[model samples]
Target: MFHSIYIAGAEAHSGKSIIVLGMMEMLKAMTPKVGFFRPVVKQEDGSDPLIHLISNRYQLPFQADELYGCTLETTRKMIGEGKIDEWVKLILAKYRHIQEQCDIVVCAGTDFAGANTGLEVDLNARLANHFGCLYMPVIKGHDRSASDIADSVRMLEDHLATHQHCEILAAFINRVPNNQTDNLKALLEGSPFPFYILPERQALGRTTIGEIARELDLKTIYGTRQSLTHEVASYKVAAMQVQDFLEHLENCSLVITPGDRSDIILGCIAAESSDTYPRIAGIILSGDQEPAPQIQKLLKGVKPMRLPILHSPHDTFTTALKVNNVEGRILPSDERKIAVALGMMESYVDMQQLRGLIASDHAKRVTPLMFEYELIQRAKKQIKHIVLPEGEDERILRAAEILSLRQVVKLSILGEEEKVRSKASHLGLKLRDIQIINPRTSELRKEFAEVYTELRSHKCMTLKAACDIMTDVSYFGTMMVHLGYADGMVSGAINTTQHTIRPAFEIIKTKPNCNLVSSVFFMCLEDKVLVYGDCAVNPNPNAEQLADIAVTSSDTARMFGVEPRTALLSYSSGSSGKGTDVEKVREATKLSQSRRPELKIDGPIQYDAAVDPEVGRSKMPNSAVAGQATVLVFPDLNTGNNTYKAVQRSANAVAVGPVLQGLNKPVNDLSRGCTVADIVNTVVITAIQAQEVKA
Candidate 1:
């Protein structure tokens, strides 16, 4: 078991940063203070983006000079001068400086990108032994066979661990094909330490707009600091006329045209505005020229454009080549890609269990960060089709880009295709392969209207009226959920909650087993995540209805890894007070346990007694759910809603839902004031729920 780890690659381009970044993410969740260091970086002056990415993303308080001992160039020169001992001392001092301030520090070995492989390997082995840290060797599995990998691992163990006295933590084999994992595992069956196999992730190699700008030193003209995170899928030189250029547009394409070509510039904007063409990642104005004054004025006169407009001094050809060759990695500015990289670590490694082996003192609880990271990975494994009704809004479009980029779920946006496309273009959004539909003019409208009429015919509904109502985006999106068109629907960004869920109630309805629908907010606090129940749906549930809420909320808690030690919350602690509310909670607790015999519940519990260990023990010593309550069930909406909001604001917690439960199919409503991040999370949860429905 080791708190700190040193990662060394078997060869150049082993892509060991994936393991480094992944380890840092896991350490951040498991421990309070985590630090990162690089023994020998490529750049001696500490201008490495990986260093900055870790410092900024994790909010480390280390300066650039404090991050690394020396550059690879410096190491080579020092070794030639017979100063290897001095170099070791320098690196050990720097590593200790960081280790002193952190609970654990993750250090990266020399970038084998272009270093002297044998010398760097020796240095890493020596440093690991000196630091008394765990040595983690990463191998590239792209073209290597089972026997090849096994031989390499055996050699490393024999050299580093056997001769150099370095503690071998684990071996990582990255970029392997799915079919090769088993053969590789079989070949290395007798390894001393566990060997982890990670498949190749294509997105890990793709560069973003910010990386291109930094690599080429392009001057930004239009995009904000945030839009710079857009990933460039492809690039093209727009040397043709406006009509021809419009005809040749591509999805997420970076357009490189002459700066003075006002016709092409306006044509690109027009393409974005019409939704008839592909989405543009950004535009590059080349040849050392600027847009004409009139064209610039026209650009300002138009509605705010998000398609990043940049200027490059080089000619179109040079700029295009530079853009294409820009290397991609997880940048501090791009949290979405960081999520993707972290997802790799989460899916392949049993990080929680691994922590027990490495850090025995680590608290056996799920942090909010770990929960959110695991949530995204879960949704990606069972990709479900989800529909968004408020497709024209900027927040919705922005979230759509992230969802599409991550490939977490299949998405359909309900709106006129042209309008949604125009919105997407204006936002510089790269919504690849997302289905767009116009509810009013869709081929399924008649079918949806007929289904609606038959379902509501008992209420004296007419076909014409049903057709008119079907034109509403909310109703259309919900109908998609009812039919096999979409697995789930998320809305209420611009609409009221009633407008968003009325159609679900009228059409999809509740499940056959569950008579009531309830809601729970996964309140992500500072350290742990807790589930708050009946916060958005039920107003004043009776004992039976409240009992149902407790049962469903417990399942929801367990679904998200919050083990349910349910507390039926009221104003009093178990049998200590007399009130109708307390009585109702006590009755509900009994009713819940009777319905689900395996439930752990105690009712008439005060909030403090239910959460504080000392208070819970003092007040309800014999009760099972006195403390350690992961799920809190509120007796009424007024209490549940107010308490959740108070904790969210006062304690700085992230309230993830009001996630709807008890539906035959999954249909979730969003708060009207939700942000782009909220929309993204809600959609992810809805997709997971849709998978549950199928199950």
Candidate 2:
């Protein structure tokens, strides 16, 4: 039997596309041969937008036309002629054609087009029952109370399960209000089947200037066309005084006015350039006018800005309504919107548990995407508090919002509470649940200083000196981890590596019997994850230190579910060449082998032989790790750091570390030039490491 799932919306504009997009992503990550099929569609409308979107986004090999089983017109005609069974047979045959080449198929249910609500619901239920597919009804929850949403979903579930006898897997409630989310989810959690709630985010529905321009066939008259990607959160008619208009504007406002209004035009430019005013998404020059010659010349004299000035043939009011009503779709090119949708789904939904209930066997290979998902899921299993020392930075605040929303960790950020809060607010991020601790005003300052004074008594540290040192955010955050108030700490987004980890070194120290502290990057290539050691710490090390780093890195790999096959990297493969570096690697390999006999360790191997199976077989035919090394140990810091970076840049690999090993407490450092995603990933890894320490 074919394995498939049907995503059906209970009403029009139910926001089920988010669930479809998320499901497609999960399926693609877990399996290779996943198919997207639409059983019926409007003939006049051609292929569905979602089908086009999935095909383009995922780069599906098949044609979009082949994905459809029947047209809405054909289905209605066949049903009127009492050939419903015949229509079902034809649809089933087409579905089987698609499924024959796939492990699993996901059929998007009928869009509420050209049919009444009851008709669409019946059609969806019939299709699911006929195809033996798992049914997931998506109910619209916009402007509804928690009790109303729950009641609607329950009635639908009963209709599908008790009346239609459909295999209902889950009910997804979309557009839930922020306050009602918890109550709605709690109500659904008591049901036998699973459920997912997507909270309301109207910003995602806002159309960008590019979309509006395309819809109205408008022409760009000034500034860059690239600025058309800005989403118009709200629109305004700029027909008043500059100061009064500025006060009326909100964030991401799309302005519409007569193009000859040079005062308003110049006012918008000044407002956007200055941080004191809201950002205008774009300007629609209505009444078929461009800026006057003098204004255009003046605009050319100033520096170029990312503001689009479009000339609209219609009047101001018409232009405003048309642009405001233009709906935004999750187009293949819109990565920002896609990220937000997927992030929301991942935050609210239990991906792993949902997969267990719905999907069966998938690809066994461990891909980088799958590995990252596993990291987030694993961290969520035992939530641990992790402190971010560089909390004032925008990247740190953005990552905190993601981690907080995902419920991946218990986060406490160290900075001035008001400063962090204001920064988060300016970025339009919500860190309401995240604890912001000001190092100078926190209650733990005295206790932390006392502990530090005792720990640093040999260095002549007094209570006053300790108290002064505790005021540093890094020191305060590290102390939280060391004192067991927080489980771990992640810093260095803005600070130097030394500033971030020095506190950990002085207070947390090393684990038992581990003298050297080194670092490794979980270099996630396209299909596999490899460990590269001593890339961030230990500029140069002797044989013993190198061996300890290797063993410690191996333990870390195994701790994260990667089987450790340690390879000592050098310029030569096996013993074919001899030099100081090769000799050092050979000695380190021997020491590591003796220390951890169970782990597969090979030495003096070139990067090629350590990774490529063919080269490995030619060079070292007898070694277990030569062909399939998951961990590589560098001879010195200079070689390790440059090589990891070169590979990362040239190969487009996601280098997710310099994860420090041999630490008594779990403290990891971020790259100064890391992205928001990097910070989030590092925080997740830190939380997982903290779980090990607590265990």
Candidate 3:
């Protein structure tokens, strides 16, 4: 069964809350634990009314902080920074934490109450797709024609299909008039998606006297609090005589009259007590004029079965006008309305179909977008401090701003304090909370230099030479990671790859079982993330070193949530050509499979045969790893580097790392032309790596 499902709105006020409330009740009936999440709430401070209602009513164990993902302002900032993927990561992190405690989760989309609603629609679709949840859109049909309702549903279906690539489990047209239900059903009969039509109920949409009094700033003069939720069927002005006014009274009618009209008030109260007359909803006394003491005494005497009497300063006409416009909301105190809504949903919606949809299996396909999202989420689970050596670079500063905003990792930047701050200010980037350190003047410089000397003393390095080396930001940043001041280091945005990784080699060195460090780029193509190895480190390796790279690269792929199916890329398909390169690749393939017997690996294969299913079937029909490889180990760095760049440019892919593996600690390098996103991704990867090392 699916672990979660998403409820989205086709438009504002689509009665999505009814579906959510009903689904929660339904799921809770089957499972003892169910979670509710609102990924984007319009309210500041992250409070949502629906969350409070569901959590409290169901006695969900989730705290208030756990129920909301973020506020509108925070969501807008993330979207503006092209960090929606990162935002999704944050949401998923929170959700996974919540899911651990529950059997299923119901994630609701945005309320569409603020600006940029169009953007919010796209965001909801992305969130649903990322969560791999069943998406059900609720369409409001009140005050809309049958044709208009059909058009809206069709348009929403097309948007989700074309833009989001999400399959709708089902949809609902809520609040349609009873007369239009059959027409709307017939119009949607041929839809590829399943849909249901719910007839309008005035009770479901009616505002109570207490609600009106609160909205119009009226004071309740006499009534039991329980009577506040009574539905108002209609409103009438009592300016005429009491006898004539009684003729116009309807069931649940709210009477508006001058406060001094004791006869009209007492007559309505008496009629409510008499079975011959229709029950009145309540009485609204207008113009702030109270009845005489005798009337007050009579009202006090009737306090045992008090009617809801409200007093407003506005005249009867103005009070009636305001009451006509009052719209009701489902408050926590209103259990009767909540029960009505739940009953309506359970009666109209197909619970069996919904349960089947929720139980259906979703194919596990990790798109590149999902892989990137998972990366940030994994990094945030155990946040580690990462130091950026090239802090003065604008890309680095911008990345720092995002990292700080998301709280993905603790950041320390190594540069001259004034220069870094000035450059950040010039670029309109905020780095106020990020740690800025001038390597030469930092308080930890002496300590870091001493540690560096101790680690490199075997090479006959003097203390003075070590101090001089520590003055360089790259060396200082790497030393911070080595000395446990920071968890990892990411640099090379303005420096060469060597300048970044060399300090790590001199101090942190390689892991005990590893001989050399290699690198891989998580080439995020359209559908999947392919790990390209030795792409930034190691120009060439012999058969044994190549096998080691394959093993390490496979571990790296799995570390970032990609299942590793190792493919050794060569110039020729299996046994099709003979050359020194082909021979090396074949030997490396044998060596890798032997070393890591658990890993599925195939080699001496052309790129086309390795990645394309049809080509692999024709070339290497019996290979387990052919055409389904997630980790591609190249024969040399030249092939891997050029191929990744070519594919990145051609396919518009996101190449996340040249993340160094086989290291004792995590230190990563970035390309000189990398964007802020690229830098942020590398830093996050480094943090995850550091977390693994600590583990």
Q: What is the C-alpha local distance difference test score of each model?
A: 0.84, 0.84, 0.82
RMSD of each: 4.8, 4.6, 23.5
How far in Å is the alpha carbon of 629 misplaced in model 1?
A: 2.5
lDDT of 1 by residue, 1-695 (tens): 24688888878777888898888877766765777888888776556878878888777888987988777788777888999999999899999998898878888888765546776778788998887778888988877777787788788778875668888878898888677888987988888777888887776777778888877889998877666877778887998878777777777788999899999898888776664687777799999999999998888877556667999999889888888777887788776677667657767876765576568586555666667667877797789999999887888988887887667889999888877886666655657789999988899999999999999999999999999999999989999989878999999899998898888889999887578989999998877889999999889999999999999999888877778999999888888889788899989988999988888988879899999899999999998888778899999999999999999999988899979998888888899899988998999999888888854
What's the TM-score of every candidate structure?
A: 0.81, 0.82, 0.53
Candidate 3 weakest ten by summed lDDT: 361-370
What value of lDDT does candidate 3 attain over all alpha carbons? 0.82
Number of the candidate with higher TM-score, 1 or 2: 2
Q: How does model 1 fare in lDDT?
A: 0.84
User: Model 2: per-residue lDDT, tens digit, 570-647?
Assistant: 889887888887788888889889988998988888889989999999999998998899999988999999999999
**Ranking of models by lDDT:** 2, 1, 3
Per-residue lDDT of 220 in model 1? 90
**How far out, in Å, is residue 43 in model 2?**
9.6
- How far does residue 252 in candidate 2 sit from its true spot (Å)? 5.9
| TM-score of candidate 2 against the unseen true structure | 0.82
